[model samples]
Target: MDDETSSHIDDTDRRTLVNAQGAVQVVRTTSESVDTRLQQLLDRANQQETEMTDVADAVSELSATIEEIAASAEQVENRSQTAAARAEEGDEAARQATERMDNIHGQMSDVRTELQSLLDRIDEIESALSGITRIAEQTNMLALNASIEAARADNSDGFAVVADEIEALAAESQEYADEIDAVLSDLRSAADSTDSELDAALVEVEQSSDEVERALDKLGAVADAIEETATDVTAVSEATDEQARVSQSVMDRCTTAAERATEMTTTVDAIDQFRAEQTAMLEEIDDALTEATPALSVTDIDRIPTGLDPLDEATDGGLLLGGQSVIQHDSPVVDVVATLCASALSAGYAVSVTPPEAMSRQDLSEGLASHGSSLSDALATDRLFVLDMFDEWTSERNIFDMRASSLADVNRETATRRDKPLLIVGNIAGEIALLGEEQARQARYENDSTVFNPADTVCNVVDERTVDESFGAFYAGAADQVLELTGDGPNRELTLRSSPTGSAPPRPLPATSTPVSPRGD
Candidate 1:
């Protein structure tokens, strides 16, 4: 039992041990294989984890880039909105500019239309002015032709009136004449009557001058005879007076009586001689006056031309053609006459005036200048002559005698000098009569050729007191002309009225044509 039992037991134990060892080894091998596989799995899991971390870093970089892109897109959207707003503003401004341009164009069109209308109106005005100018020219031409025809007919009255009208027309034309041809027409009218009037006047004056020459010779003989008789009478008276003185006492008385008788006889003889001489002078003066009468005829007056209508009408188309004597009284009537005479001279009359003391020379000069004449030119023409009567008269007898003598002498002289009219003025009532009535009448009647009555042609110069009323009355009267020169407030008017009958008015005298002031060139 023992050995076999030991061996069997051992075997049994060995078998049990081997089986248990084999089972344990197999379980250990399975666990190690599982641990290696788990390690490999863990290593793979770690690699996966590393891969996951790298992926996460890459994802963060991509997210930051996406955020930057979003910001850029927002900025671009804002810029686009700003651009759209600016474009809308620019379009609105353009529309407003177009509207302003349309308004300006409309204003320009209206201005153009107004300018065209103004041009049309200017053309119409120019046409009207042209028509008026043409009418004025034609009127002037007609006046000129009429004046020329009248002058050729040798009708002085017609010539003077027509010439005056023509001159007025010419003056009117001067304001509008644009050429020399129109001025030539005026000159032709002025020249037409000069030669015809001068020739006729010259012929009449020549005939009268011859008659004056004969009268002068006869008067000279009478004067010499009167002087011789007076000398003889004086000698006889002296002889008788000497004889009376020689005889003394009673004889002296007888001698004185004889001497007185002789002196009386001598006085009577001298008076007779003076009377004869005066008669002879009167006869001579009458002859001279008679010869001068024809030269002063209206025919002579008609041949001359006067350029002024007022002057020609006042003087019956001429000046004092009939060698008439005009008397002027105090009241500036003399001044009126002087103005008339001056106007006559300007119209080509040769005038002579004897001014009284009452006439104002300064007023006369100013009056002439106012009539559109330079004082120097009026004086230099020798057309007007003035005699101061105040300077000529010495005594009362001298005044009467001088007036008579001067009238006779002037009448004779004027007959010789012709070519223009003459005016003689005298202060007839101013002188006192030295001779008796019969003697004075004889002196006046014999010496003077033309006698004028004061009532018929006397012009009273109105004083300040009754100037307005007197002037109105005078103007209404039937005189050849009325001249009213007065200072009325701030105005001065020279009114002239023509006589109802076309005859020259009575002119007192010509005034001295003295220069009032210096002349301008």
Candidate 2:
């Protein structure tokens, strides 16, 4: 379900604040139980890095694709324009052909008119021939009748010869008339056939012109379709570019988010482990305090050794089982005392952190972590408890306020002292809490009251960031052993301001084996 949701969000470009917060909370919750969540964050960061690379590659490919598309669209546009131009030219040609056809039809019409005129002339000729024939027929008939009368009169007159000549002339006129009629009939038939053929040619030319016009229209439509396709391709290219830009933004944001989550995971792991340790110590201490009595013997002293081998040897083997030491820490490095603290714990010392000058909760957790101790582990084992006077927001910090209502409450005496070593470091968050003279004086006074116990080691850290002369002077005066810490890097200078209760100050302390945090600017 979560994977699907994540995919959908990535697809939709939803980066709302609420969702980010929810995701962070989930990561934190996971880290609470195990380091798996941190690993997951790491994996996610790695995946995002890979994804960003892929996106870059994809963007490059998309750019190339877009260029290709643009080229194709341009080509298509050019082709469509060419096609449309040809269509226009074809329309012009078709129009010219139509005009030519019209002109031919008109010419044919004129030819028909000339043919009709010729026909009219033929008709006149035929009419004249008809009149001559009729006249000839009448003359022939008269000549015939005259010849018969002569023959009947039994006279050999020359009139019979005149009548026979008239009859022959009549026969020649009829022959001419018949020839003129035959010529007129043939002319009429030829004129009618030529006119019909001309009409058919005109119809065919007109049909061809119409077909050309239709073809031009279809060509125009095809050209328009190609133009429209080009436009759509161009639009798709632009949209792809926009999508690529959006993808780039998402990758950038994811990279940043992954980096931050990874850092948080690291810090959280440290705190959680340390918190667990402290919890365990706290539970043990609580049980001891409730059931155990305040008592100590010489045997208990051997169990209260500070973790540092040299420091322990210099201080006559180690701290007394119920002794208190004051450390004037010149640097902000938390590990300055880590060796001693862890060493003391190994010797069965239960430690409690109530620092007076931690800048924040991370400051406390980071400090303990540098000393080879997990704050969570200490808390879980009931050997440590943070009085919330520190950063009220440190995750390892118990949310409930640990700030004492009255200065005296801060000075509350150790409830019980058993055979086990009890080491309490007072005021882990006092740097910000005690800035002024009054606050410093009161905090110092409260701490002074709590310095002594039957069988425990009270450790006080005087961070120069907040501890003024009055604060340090009070803690040093109250403490049995005093140590001064100063350094920036690996070569830290440790000096014993005050040694054990007996014997001369031992040889100067050697260099620390464990690394101390680099001094801040």
Candidate 3:
């Protein structure tokens, strides 16, 4: 009783002690709340840490990918630079080659001309020899007659000496005529061989010239592609750097939040301190999350590569910003067409195709698939647009279907020029002609007009056996140049019949076939 009374004291003292106990209860509740908040903050921090770890892993993976991309871009850039330099060199060399071929042709022509002149002189010499032979024959006959008369007149001794001298002279003249005839025959044979060899050499030089032009065109395209790829790689590197910086900033905030949580845990026993710390930590987390900035985006590239040296050359650096070309071949080069399209897309040029209506969709897809991944990606991204002519279209994915009912409408769009070249595949000229006389007339007008911009390059393919002679002549006259293909399979023969810009004769182009696979065999 005494101890309880002492502890309690008076009513006032008892009240004070009760108030103290209530205060203790309040402190305990506050402490519990503080602990709850701290645990909540800690849990949140832990979740954030897990997220940060995920982000770190993601960033690491992205960085590795970016590094590979950067490396590839660097390699591409370097190769492009080399290709550009090589193309320039090739262009110059081709120009020189053209000049040399011209010189050779002229020299051969001169040689032929000089040989003809020599033949003309030989004809004059032969005429002289013929007269000498006739004279010799007459002399021999006279000598024989004189010897017989001398024998008949019984004056054989003196006449025989004279006859013998005449006979000797005739024999000498006859031998000279025979030698002249033999010399003439040898000269004619040599001239014929020389003429044939000159013609062959001229043909070879012309062929070489065509090959050079094609190589230059291809190399130029490759250079353009490399430069564009390098640019993209550089942009990726910059983005990666920015991402790394942001990740570092996030980690710093995470560390700060973790330290705050630790302080809060330490002060869990002191609710007043805990409350202050929790408020500050929440603000820090909010600020850090809110303040994080996003990275910028990369821009699209331009001027792609055409894998084919000849095609690239004809198009003047892979169907680039400026320049136009037309091709008509005597073979089904669907693989070649697809390969070029793939090359262009890989190099960053937007492409659109108006496939032959005769071609089945499944076959077209299979043919395109023969090329590889770039074409698939191009279609997926809508970078490669296909204008379905007959409404029967098939593709790996759903694509934009441009249903132009009339050829004129298609022609109108075809004439509407863009920044990049459009590739018109299949029998383009033949198809246009088949669009009826009215449409053909319109196509003719479009072809002749200054406003014409169908494609930077137009390529038409037809089999050698089936290609119309008239069609070949039409394109030959209409196009800036003509490449006539013959044979089939891996070693098809391409002959450059004419180029308005060149003086060389028909040249045989190098045999090129689309690889079995797109990445190349």
Candidate 4:
């Protein structure tokens, strides 16, 4: 080969190696994110599956309870029907008793009338007996007079004998009259007693008839009430039956849902297995990629490593010297900025635009201290710069304020102050969180004013919670790369996207043994 051709081939090979190394880092980073998200989804699916199983059990119990209620309702209905029948029978018996009482009362009245008539006949017989007694006495008196006259006329024999016979006959007639009178008196007395008894019995029978009538009326009302109750009970039983049927249908649906949930769980398990396989494949590919281009290592390049190993790997070594990195987070990014500042301070000067409300100097210092760096020492050595994002920049004594100043001025001034590469960290999201969107917008505008000096590396941290998605997208679009942090605490994850249009899929930040706290607290 010609000398120039050989030289061109060497340059092309070197460039290809660099590109291939960058691609490996990107793939490795992307796979991590996929793995984290997949694990989260698997956990959620398992929880849902357990919850669905519990729901199925509850529905089964409800179905059983409904069946029991239906059975009880049926029993009540049968009992009510029986009660109605018994009431009806009682009512008929009461009616019959009332009729019998009425008949007995009528018979008693007839007997009473007959007894009274017999008493009246006995009285008449007594009167006739009295008359017969009086006649007998008169005849005896006449016979006595005839006997005395015969004695006075001394006419013995036949006349005197005739008078005596007449006297004896009169005496016998009087005796008979007395006996008939006594018998009549006795008959009258017996008849009076019988009439009194019959009258009493008739009264009792009448009262009994009235009592039975009342009872019959009451029984009839009870029978009607019982019948109504029976009907209501029957209706209740039917409604219970319907409810049981509906419950059965619901249970059936619940069973189907349970089956579906079980199927879903199985599907999720399958998906998890697939994800595991994909992850294994990714790891293998990453390993293969790592071996393919061992000659072109990221350490050979002059890039800044963010102390965070995961972040360094995601960025393919670290931030480019003049590139702008946007740190987007759901929470405060003070810790993120501090970590960046600490790393930047190692190589060159670090500058931060901070709002006191979001993070005071002490807070930032503490955050830096956690990473084994001293913010005060960096400031003493003139390697760190702090600016108040909300206050006006006044005199040298108040160089921290920068409300009237712009990022462009800071960028230019910082460059003149130090020949070393600068790391500029802006808190646009912090301003929005503490101040308002308007101020954040102003901050954004100020940041836009600064030119991309090759001697400086710029980073702007934004809290995703404080801004709209479109605004986040817009902010990300203006940056060279985006470092996005998600979740909180143990579940937190970080991803990096290095696409100019932000179209590239996000890759997981390089894994770290311990995560940096979002709030630096």
Candidate 5:
């Protein structure tokens, strides 16, 4: 408006107009700058809101993960608690078992010691019984000799009393011995049963120990798994922590889960230790049982003969002969007669049997063959003599006479021939007894050699069923050595009764030594 005042007045008005226009332009520029700055602030606030939303979403995911981890941690904590309880129970059970085993071992040790003592006592008892038996036998022999002397001196009352006392003592001793033997047998049976029971117990313990060992192995595996899980959980927790620095909420739950897994591993380890200890204890028990099985052999086998050497050692040293032996029979003595006849024939000695009718010749031959002697060799040796009394007798009286005469001839011939051993067998003991004592004594001698009296060689044979006081009297008076051959369990056993050298009264003749044949040679 002012161009120069029209020019001056006009100038003043123009200046005012120009100044107002400048102020207005300055206002418009300031307003535009403020509008641009406000628009920028709004855009930045929007970006900040988006970032806030993303953080919120991330926090939400972290919270969910933390909840899941919390649940897992709780489950792991429960499992660890359960495992801890189980481990405690296992430890308690193992401790109880160990205590029980200790008690069992103590009891077993005491039992073993007691058993050893009992075995020693039994051995002592057995030895005492044997000694008693020997004493009884000696007493019996003494009683028998005393009876003979009393009868000869006509002291009947003394003889009866002495005999009664001796018989009673012998019976008592035998009863005691039998009782001891029975007790020993029972002890042996008990020992065998105990051994069987111990073996079964050992087997059961071994199986239990194996099962416990397997359980321990499984627990160890579980512990290893838990450890691996804990390691993985720790790694996850660390990654979550780094993420939480960028975002914040997930690391805490991962750390808690790792701690729970570690706790579960500790419980498993405790259980494994308990099982391992139990297994070790069972192994020790098994070892102890295995060590205790060899000292029970007292009454299991028979006592072998004392004087005889081993069969292999005695191959060159044959059986010794020349003892007065009697073979008594109920019907006919088959085994004893055959054995003696075979032995004599094999020894290359002239052998004679008085009653050939009593035995089978074929049986004799076969028996000889069984004893390593050929039947042909025995027959060809011309050493076996058979006196057939049946052919020599015409009547019953003659039969008796013939038997008596033949026995006398056999005795006389055997006594006269020192080089030959005689095996005289008779079917009837009555026939031999019928001969007068003087005649019998004479018949028992060959020339000046007496072979059927105590001072020489004597033997008495009487049937067991018919053996009585009279038989005993005859046996006591006539024999130096009397043997009763009896059948017992697939064998023929000989029971010997003899007089001691200085105990009885002196005899009419001096002792005569019979010739003996060497073995194998």
Candidate 6:
């Protein structure tokens, strides 16, 4: 072969090799971008599952509240109905009393008429007595004249005797008239007294009748009001019942959605696994390409901040990437965990392990929100992962149903899933409650060997009030860093008791370190 031909062939082979390397680089870049998008999709699916589960729970709570309202409304309706019936009865009774009073008033009027008639008869008797007296006087005068005539006629004895007898008869008639006049005056006085009494009785009866009529009117109004109230209560009860039914239906649908979301999450997991395999293949291809070219550079940070300035300063930038930390606190552990999670997530991905009942998702979300981040968004972006550990007593999927040691593996895998530094915060007291003290101690011992990865930064919180001295001491002794929280509310303090490098100093906690209440509160 000629020298020019060999040189030309070599240049052609070099150009082809250069083109292949460029294509490999472009493919690797594209694969990385695709991998990131797939990861985001998987995270969104997981977030949807969590949201669906929360919706189901909220709906159930609403249904229960609706049922309680319905029950209260029913009670109100029953009491109002009883009151309405009693009011009606009282109205009827008042009407009967009013009728009786009217009858009494009529009877009293009749009596008054009779009394007036008696008064008239007494006055007539008085006139008759006056006439009798006048007649008596005239008769006496006639007798006296007869006596005088007898005296003048001398020897008329029989006529004089007859005149005397007539005078005596007139005297007796005057005496009887005077007696009748006295009796009539007494009768008239009694009639007047009786008539006055009847007038007073009639006034009282009329007053009572008026009062009874007013009372009947008031009773009728009360009955109507009570009936309306009962009807309104019945309507409220029925509405509450309907609301309960609707809430129950909503809960059922939410449960179904949650189940479907779970299935979707499972599918996402499969996709993620497939993506991992693809990533591995891409990485292999890149490794081979690197042999023919310069390798890409990557910078790794060994520590992450704990969000608390003093804590970060004390721990020399926070927690070591591959070390375990123990936090023993007299104050609420939830706040400390929140602070740690918020800070760690600022740098990289984070995994929080806690019991389902220890701290609600809303509380955690609010904690994140306080740091100017959204929990749902973080979760959907795969920057934050929450693992709920439920005990046998809890209604959630119990972690205790599996081997206690398996939780360490699960936590480790979750912490190491991403290439980024991960912070794992757990509540030791909650774990103890799930798996008794002895089992928890054993698990803790096992966790040291299996739970941590080289890139994992783990913080375990222990409530001083919940665990014994020995248990807390053991955890402290095993951890690379030991932090203690003291005091309460705004006065709370975070102090590093032990450090792997022994450089971090104690610092005052912020006023916001006060307990983060649940979302509902």
Q: Best candidate, lDDT-wise?
A: 6
Q: For candidate 1, which ten residues in a row score worst on lDDT?
A: 1-10
**TM-scores for all predictions:** 0.25, 0.40, 0.37, 0.56, 0.34, 0.51
Candidate 2 accuracy as lDDT = 0.55
Candidate 2 vs candidate 3: which has greater lDDT? 2
* Winner of 1 and 3 under TM-score: 3
Candidate 5 lDDT by residue in tens digits, 284-314: 5434433432221212221111111221022
lDDT of 3 by residue, 1-521 (tens): 11121111113232233323323433444445566766676666556656655665666566666667656666766766676577667667766876786787788778878877887887898889889889999999999998888888875889888998999999988998898889887987887787788788778877876786777677667666766766766676677667656665665666566566556545543654656675566455434433442211112112234566654454334432222233455555555555666665554445566554444444445544544534456566655666564565753442334443454454444445334444444345335445643454355445434333422344444443444443333344333335555555555644555443342333334543343333220
The better-scoring model by TM-score among 2 and 4 is 4
**What TM value does model 3 have?**
0.37
lDDT tens digits, residue span 1-521, model 1: 11121111112233233323323333344444444555555555555555544554554454455445545544554554555455455545544544554455455445545545654554564455456568666767777777777777765676768777866866666565534344434443433343344445445544444444454454445444544444443444444344333322334344454455455555555654555565455445445533442321233323122233544545555322322222212233444555654565555545455444455555555656655654445545554444443454333211223444554454344434433444444333332122333342243334332432111112223333322332223222312234444443224233443322343433323233432222100
On lDDT, the stronger of 5 and 6 is: 6
**Any residue pairs clashing in model 3, and if so which?**
371-518
Residue-by-residue lDDT tens digits, candidate 4, 80-122: 8888888888888888888788888878877777777887777
Q: For candidate 2, write residues 6-121 as lDDT tens digits.
A: 11111111112222322333333333434455456556655665665566566656656666665666666666667666666766676676677667767767776776787678
lDDT comparison, 2 vs 6, better candidate: 6
| lDDT-better candidate, 4 vs 6 | 6
Candidates, ranked, TM-score: 4, 6, 2, 3, 5, 1
Candidate number with the higher TM-score (2 or 6): 6
Q: Can you tell me which runs of candidate 5 are displaced by over 4 Å?
A: 1-55, 199-521
C-alpha lDDT of candidate 5 relative to the true structure: 0.46
Task: Give the top-scoring candidate (TM-score).
Answer: 4
**Regions of candidate 1 where Cα sits further than 4 Å from its true position:** 1-320, 323-330, 371-382, 392-407, 410-419, 430-521
lDDT of residue 59 for candidate 2: 60
